[model samples]
Target: MDPKVLDQAAERAGIIPEYIDAWGQRKVISTETKRQLLNAMAGVADDLALAAALPPVWVVREGESAVLSVALSEPADWVLTEETGRQHAGYLSGGRLALPAGLPAGYHRLALRRELRHWSCQVIIAPPRCYEPAALLAGHKLWGATIQLYTLRSQRNWGVGDFGDLALMIEGTAKNGGAFVGLNPIHALYPALPGWASPYSPSSRRWLNIIYIDVGALDDFQQSSAAQQWWCLPETQGTLSALRDGDLVDYAGVMALKLSGLTLAFRHFITRGPEDPQRRSFEAFVREGGESLRFQSTFDALHRHLTLAGHPTEGWQQWPEPFRQVDSDEVREFRLKHHQDIRFFSYLQWLAARQFDDCFQLSRRLNMPIGLYRDLAVGVSAGGMETWSDRTLYRLEVSVGAPPDRLGPQGQNWSLPPQDPNVLFARAYEPFITMLRANMRHCGALRIDHVMSLLRLWWVPLAGSPQQGAYVRYPVDDLLAVLALESHRQQCMVIGEDLGTVPQEITAKLQAAGIYSYKVLFFERKDPAQYRAPDEYVPQAMATLTTHDLATLRGFWQLEDLRLGNRLHLYADDAIYQRLLADRQKARQALLDALHAWKCVPAKLGKNAERVVMSPILNRGAHRYLALSQSALLGLQPEDWLDMALPVNVPGTTDQYPNWRRKLVREVAEIFDDQGITRLLREVDRLRNKSADGQNSSPRPE
Candidate 1:
């Protein structure tokens, strides 16, 4: 390693040489790298300084006064204080200003504005906390399910699955054995563009993207003359017809129709909807959103400015001056001018919520135990909605990823920027708690994706590759406490996707807190099996034959599963594949032996036993809540082959892969009604019952 490179990188990361020796051994930085490091650090420091010097904002009690302090670059002649808050004297030696006494609070905004230097942020003085979440979920049960939204559709929806479709699905699932219907995130996308689909990589997480709303189902749409005229159009009629026939989802077409309808509805709302309860509810949502809403509104306006100017809003760094700074007067004025656009975005959220609520209500009506098990992704994109709006809460310079393991030789670098837990706790975990509340609103249970993130995340510097990230610890107790409290309050069951090389402590902690962990059948070893047996599965966890990321049961059986190993050429030599195949054969044999041992299989059972047995995958997993994906039930080897031809995700690649854009081959509505699929569900149900009764079955408790 080059010493000069090491020094340069160290300087860039703001590490003293001594600190470098202590922390950066074996890592080298070139002299040329040092110059780039200096430049980047300078930019980072500039951004940090602006963020830190903003305001003395505090969240306090309504009756209490809030004390404030400021660490500034220079001294000010006069201190600025709002009427509601108290101002104090006695400047510290370092030109820091401290408020001597606290002032009564409601909503307080304190700023230091001395001739062209101004900074401000709204602060809330909260009421005493009466809502502790743990007590809520301790004895509560939930009922819910989640699938790709486009998979299901009703006779009344557009080409893509809409609110109407979801409501129907929820009702149907509840009527069956399920209680809730969880959905992929329906957050808003950049409006100007329609087809850049992937709900996970949304333009905004806080706001609902309007495309999912069912225009024809809305009460307001029926009352509107414009909607009636639009509905009469041949194209509109054709679209509806195609949707009922289970056509592929044309996201662009759906978005176009929805936007036009919503715009018209907004006009109607502003002009004639004077005493409507729905109108009032929309206003209430806006008020409750507060500064967070303001930030989104501001971003929408700025994004439009850049878009109209023929620039990609995605490339904000390349934008000209006055456009780059989020707080510039130009951006502020743009917000004031384009307030309608912001309100439009807000309106979309209201509509989505209304639809989501209907789905939840339908599930409750069906009396399902757990409703809507929503999945929360492990992390957010680097500069996406969460990162942009909650910048202070995240460390953009550090990326989260997985360490190299048997599966991934070079490890995994998920380019999501992780939250600065320190900043999160300081703000009392408002971001995390809010996200949970939002999800819980229409969910019966919550599935935390990559649940291990609650413990620690590997952080890589922005300039570094996937392999260079460092492991950083988080306050796991506080994180789990918040989750427990929120989940209990929501009366939702929590399931953690505890796959991969998860630290052992995480599983213990989760189990202790009553959070269910995930168990997959594909990873089980049955020959002198290290994998748990059916009776050995923890009664509280969710048992599954496969996950969205892993191959379906059929694919696993055929040795065609896609994973990081295959994608990264880690298994190019075929040695690993051969071993895996051999292991698979052994596992299959073990399952047959166990079943025969239990007297479930007849002595006449032949070589075809492997092909006939579903008990091994369904009965032999270590979780109580057994979930089989539709693909597995259908014997579909590759989910992508069921419709589109691509894996939902290929782990380590971004541009070289399509992460989450595959549309299911079979429309969701069709699948539910399909005779073949229905039979499979019944068969799986039969096997599950047999296994539960301690009949002839394989080991493991799926």
Candidate 2:
């Protein structure tokens, strides 16, 4: 291919020709790789003819009063229709058309006609920035507990943590003056194939994960004879007990138990008269869910059907052509044949949504300030429902990942497809808006994972190594505008996960948009011996000592992560491992010194101590230290409070480590009942209040 043609293709496809690496080195994408990515973007076709025949999608700010330019071969009459169906007609003169400022802020359709030659495009009007809650901007220091919802073990739940556990946890936290409960992404995962249980690798971000539904919380569950009989069985009870007692979550077993009970409940509900009030509510839910819900339910039922018929269910791409396309006549016929099964999945969604809403209501009743904070993953899995339902929006040939850095020298491929920016713009960003709104529902705050993706993403071709990838730019202004609009509409504070290989400009942009930054204590220390002063931390940030991806406070103190990494063969060599160990030792000693200086830990605990062990004193001290920060939001992990040694997830490895299945050392009841844990939380609450009142002492950096 000609270099000029490739350059033009890259420009049109929004592929960045060069980017600054993590080490601040500028690197150029290979010519061949650029060509491949552009081809994967479907931009190599006869674009000249298509471009000449069609008008490109246009975007304007809500109050910009902008004019749109169209390359017209002849004068044409234009008709513009707002999303509300209000239409405006005007005659196109020359090639430019002026738009009225009175147009509402939404997606509007623009149609051009001249001598029967018709063309149409989408015009998006977006707000300037995301919504900023008044409480967040009021300079209040609020504290919350972040937990992997599945790790929450409760007596009432069958095996996995459910909405009931969340409700109970909220009550406990609120009693101790907590403001919110942070959770991992609760996006929809595969119910039929329960073994595929990575929360981040979800089937659909626009729906709830049905596995979190508490069967007993369903309206007719207790009244149903079938459900009661199943729950009363000795074998079923034994299975639930075993799952709850296990160290790792048994996703398949738990899902089986829950599904059996849910099926019975569904049967019992359907037996009710058609005009029952409960039945009407369910129908309304389905109607409101509309096509997205229908597609997800159809995909779930079809996958199960295919699997039962001895066909592979890993991905729809491997299915026969007719069954692959979601809109195909064959797929529609199959859905009709298995309509009952599809509705079963839809019912599960309704139950999950209802249960989650109950938790939100309970939070409100408890008077928790922020209520619940939900996480939003960056992208969906490659063979997931979203990809199958809308193939045109994603570039399946390339994977989204991070380039080689200090953490992973070989680079990291998340095995998730990146959205095609061009296609996303062409669709008027309805999918993006829908996803934002879905996640923000029934939540006070939304945490966006890898928020930098809104501006650009590293697209690694599947056939090449991650190091050979290129950064692809997106319509950042448009996306941010939509996010602001959704945030305002939902009244949810937005927290952007702006860590790792992020540009400084991105941080500035996020800060200006009233989005909170995520700051981990481990990354805040400038040197091994000295942490950043508490007063130096950003005021508009969520501060934490560790994250799910890193070692807990106990693990960090014991250096268990290094040992685990060595056993898992994550280090490049023994030398690198030894270097990391030495660094950890220094950092540990520095932390001990800081704790002594701050009087967080007992001053008698030697400042010169060579090593710190996992103890209640040290764990509580860590929490207190982070609570003293100037950050407006403080998040504490229950695993750290319980002194759990294992990290929830180990980056750069999949099968080698139980990534997301580790259960918390203590159950929900035990955690709430532990006096020591309660005392520590109270101390955190006190310190947070002191900070909010501006009565805390200035940080004494050691």
Candidate 3:
């Protein structure tokens, strides 16, 4: 193929032929890779020829004039219908029509007619910016607690944190004057195969994870004889106790126990008949869930059945060819044959939804401003239900990853496929819309992980190394418009995780769109010796002392993560490991110095605080330092309060460090009861309130 033709095809398919790296270095994509990607996208003998023959969809900003270009064999008339059902008629003069600029902001349909032939396309008119909540811009500083929900342990929970635990957390935080309770992504994961436990790598982002549902909290559980018998079983009780006592989450064991209890509850519910209120409610949920729900439930049932039959259940691709596609006849037949199994999965979802809804309602009743703030993962797992159901919208031949940077010297391959930008636009962005709506349903705020994905994603070919990846562009304006629309409709504040290799333009755009930026204290410092002053932090951001991916406050001070990394052989060599250790020590010393200078540390620490060892004073001082930041929202992790050393996640290594499996040192019941924890929280609340008042009183220039 000619190089020009290949380049044109790649451009049409939204593939970047060349781009700048994170290190400000220009990188070019190989022609062979471009050809392979284009071929994978469109199964055409000549992509350039095919691109010339196809008509392009029109995407125009609202209040802008547009010209429609048509390939008409004869003189034709065109009809335009706005989203509000308003229709306009016009004639195509020589295959071109001048469109007026006053159309409403929405997805409008355009139909072209010439003799007996007809063609149509969707025209999207998007708003200028995302929705901004009045309260977020009111110049008030709010504080919240971020938790890894699975690690939350309560006496009543079935080993792992549940919706019941979330309610308790809300109560505790609200009592301490917290405005919100932040959570890790609670997206759906496989229940049958519990070993795949990364919340960020979910099966589907649109649904709830059943593992978070408190099966014992169900109303019918206490009434049903089967449920009571299962709950009271000696072996079941023993297993639950063991799970609660374990240092790490026993995903497989806990899920197995919960499934057994859920099965009993389902059997009892079914016996109650369709006229029962609860049964009717479940049916209503299924009806509202529509095809998305049905498809996910079908996939779950099939996956379980296959696993039970001792067959591979990694992904839908491994299934028989006839059953691979969601719309296939074999899948339809399978659904009919396994209707009860599918219903059971649907029932689980309904249960999860109800419990989650209860948490939000309880928070609202407590008068929390931002009740529950949920997280949105960057992408779903490659072998998950989302890919299986919507294969065309994703490019499975390549994975989404980050190029080599300071943090990841060898680069990072997340093993998740990139969404095909062309397919997303061709489908009128319904998938993205659906996902946002589903996730924003009962949350007051939504944190978009790796929010840069809206503008671009680093794409690494499956057969290539992460270093060989190139950046691919996305429709930023359209995506942001849809995001703003959903944020407004859901009455939720948006927070973008714009960390690591982010362009200044992206941050400027996000600020203009009213999305809050995420700022971590560790990254705010220019060097180990100097930290960004509290007043220098952005007011439209959520400031935190640490994130799940980084070392906790205690871990950082003690160099626990570094030692563990070395033990796991995560470092490239002994020199690199030693260099990282030295850097960590310097950072720790600088942090102590900053804390002392800010007067956050106790008087006993004195001027030589850097020489002092890790202690409760240093931990609390670090939290206090972060709480004094000018950022509008401050989030503190429970692990930091308890002085825990383990990190929740370690990037680049999956199984080496027991990622996402560590439980909190203290149980949910004991966390708030500790006098030290309560005192620290009160101090944080006082500082944040004082800062807000000070800001409000200070006059600003007109």
TM-scores of the models, in the order given: 0.72, 0.94, 0.93
| Model 3 lDDT per residue over 1-702, tens place | 899988877776777777766678887898877876776576432432344211435667555677766655467888889889999998776767766658876677888787777778777676656655555567678998999999998889888988999999999999988899999999999876898889988989999999998988887787799789878889889998999888899899999989889988888888887798998999999999998999889989999888888875667778778878888888889899999999999999999999999999998999888999999999998888999998788889888998888778688899888888777776678889899999998989999999999988888888888887777778887788788767877888899999888866688889877789999998888777778867778998999999999999878877888888888888889999999878876777677767766778866886553567778888878877877788999999999989999999987677787888899988877999999999999988888887877732222212
Residue 664 in model 2: lDDT:
86
Flag regions of model 2 displaced more than 4 Å.
44-57, 62-65, 72-123, 320-322, 697-702
Candidate 3 TM-score, C-alpha based:
0.93
Choose 1 or 3, whichever is better by TM-score.
Answer: 3
* lDDT tens digits, residue span 577-658, model 1: 7776677666666655544544344555643435654433333221122322211111121132232234454554555554
Give the range where candidate 2 is weakest over 10 consecutive residues by summed lDDT: 44-53
Supply candidate 3's per-residue lDDT for 400: 90
Q: Which of candidates 1 and 2 reaches a greater lDDT?
A: 2
Root-mean-square deviation of every model: 8.5, 2.5, 3.1
Which segments of candidate 3 are over 4 A away from where they belong? 43-80, 88-106, 112-117, 123-125, 695-702
Q: Estimate every model's Cα lDDT from 0 to 1.
A: 0.57, 0.85, 0.84
Per-residue error at 604 for model 2, in Å? Answer: 1.7
- Per-residue lDDT value at 378 in model 3: 95
lDDT string, candidate 2, 405-459, tens digits: 8888888899899888877766667788899989999999999999999899999
